[model samples]
Target: MSYCEDTIKKMLPKAYVRKHVAHEIYVAATHFKNLVPMMDKYVYNDGTTKDLMSLTGTIPVLFNDKTYNIPICLWIEESYPQTAPICYIRPTREMMIVRGKFISSNGEVEMPYLEEWKNGECDLVTLLQVMAVMFGDFPPVCIQPHSEPEQASCWLQFQRQAEVLSKTDGSFYVSLLREDDQPFQQDNETSC
Candidate 1:
């Protein structure tokens, strides 16, 4: 096996967090050669430390309502060179849409498998491939959310639900917050 795969194998056996696909994710990322572009769009380039202290970082922002995780931040942690990086969500007022000049992929409205991506068997590379196969044909567009209060309320409700469910399972709950209140420092890792 290659270095990344070997590293993943080593980590998987010692992982304490149940349901953590960290190693699996790293393995897929290293093994999949064709996914380089997509991965870079979301992840920090090799050998570079991600500066997440600004408004942007490596974490991906995905909505529970979508098919493929769109308009996301790809996050890598300081422990990444030794451990798997953690991906997180970023909430934006601008309707989250696939970043492209043309509509190549459909938003959650058309993609059904997106909502479960994080916890599903699919990893970053697989998710990108699926995005190309399913959404590559269309152009990109600005996705309008339902409404301000409606969106906030829905997010709040989901946060509550996620908390309740996560307590039973070993899953982590993510919250939607304003850009100013962003808990992490981000430095626009991605141009978009």
Candidate 2:
């Protein structure tokens, strides 16, 4: 057995029902090698937390002739297979989540496939395929403009200054300082 299979079996050791879940996870891992299976804590909106199996990695989304690997996390509940896994788009520091019809502002994914998930019929591989297709049509994330390390640092500093100015004064002007000694004006005049 592969490492992923072993991990799934160990993490989801319930009984006969979980066997199917293990199989599904193993299949998904085989299909998407980039995704790694691990056990993690999932916190519910009601302040309840549960240790659950999760797959964290990227899914390839083809857009405009280029492929972009979109980072994502799939949290499988104990009652998975019976219920759909809670999915989220986990963007890196250099990326920003794009709220769209399929993805929420917080990166939570909601679609017809997940909404109408039926046990036995729905599986992880199919879910991932659907996600890829949907994301291709409407990307859930975009690469942040300030990708360079120096620019990123300048952006952070600008944000900090803006926050301080906002708290101290009602109106403030924010601009990002670039390495070329040019001021990237975000706004001419802004009131907090």
Candidate 3:
């Protein structure tokens, strides 16, 4: 089978396991293709692998010393070609924590600091560009009252360490990976 077919076939079972997983993989692959080349060079977090794509309106924001990639999962009807994907990122032990948002794909409820993504017009390239512009180095910093005060603090530390790390460490390092997962693959000729 052709590479695309093979990749799709390999992904089919996992996709079946969870539609979101498949979608995440697809989005990651797409984002990887569009993102990596643009980077002058940088290392990904150890063991970090791109999972399925979930629509997140959360633009990357810096508060304390850490970077938080936020996404909101909202209830979206099944209307292919018209309906955009509803995906979100929830509060995790190691990442940013937000209030009233559990990371799941069911509901139309509004979220805090949501930035309503224009899914119909968005693509992997545009998405990555958006990420780079929003969350890229030298983002404007701000403090919010109440709720995620710790998150705000984390960003401060993250940036300080990141500066030192960037200067002292190698910019290019292969990320650790599980045997079951393959690195993202890109087709130069393909368009999303």
Candidate 4:
């Protein structure tokens, strides 16, 4: 086992990994040779210090009868499985970070599947698959990454997005805002 593999095994019990395929998820079912989970921490709004591990991967999202690889981050925390991993779109300097009710300007994310996490039942695979399906409604787009330091912040991109969302005929913006208020449904399992 490599360093990441070893770290994962330490984070989660070996017996549990064998039984639940947690190890498989770390490797994305052999699709990825290794998972480079960066050691990080997140302080949530509730004054909680969440120990976070982030890894980038492409999730096949079905949209318009086609599939697209959505570049995203799987932010695993100490309370994973019992709590769903926080998902974030890996934005390039050119990619406009979509700030919706569920998606924050700083790449914080909340999706229905995550809210529906059930201990010992839902794992990373199921959650990712669900996000892939959910993304059909909101297409992902990216631009060329700017080399300038000033344009590197996702917040600047969000400001630009907010401007566009504020313009009249911004029905799209309203929809996203509405979705933020909507509750995550536990029974909504219609992922392709």
Best by lDDT: 2
Q: What tens-digit string does per-residue lDDT give for candidate 3 at 1-192?
A: 112323543544342333433344355445443211110111223854433323333344332333334332222222311444333333323343222222222222332223444545543334444443433333222122234464355444333323322324544211222233543222221100
Name the regions of candidate 2 deviating beyond 4 angstroms: 1-4, 13-16, 147-192
Tens-digit lDDT track of model 2 for 17-94: 566777888999888776888888888989899888888988776644446677899999877888999999988775
What TM-score do all the candidates reach, one by one? Answer: 0.28, 0.73, 0.30, 0.56
lDDT of 3: 0.32
Model 3 segments more than 4 A misplaced = 1-6, 9-30, 33-80, 98-120, 136-192
Q: Where does the lowest 10-residue lDDT sum fall in candidate 1?
A: 52-61
Local distance difference test scores for all models: 0.35, 0.71, 0.32, 0.54
Ranking by lDDT: 2, 4, 1, 3
Which lDDT tens digits does candidate 1 get at residues 80-142?
Answer: 333323332333554444433223222222343344444445455554445444432331223
What is candidate 1's CA lDDT for residue 116?
48
Of the two candidates 2 and 3, the one with more favorable lDDT, higher being better, is 2
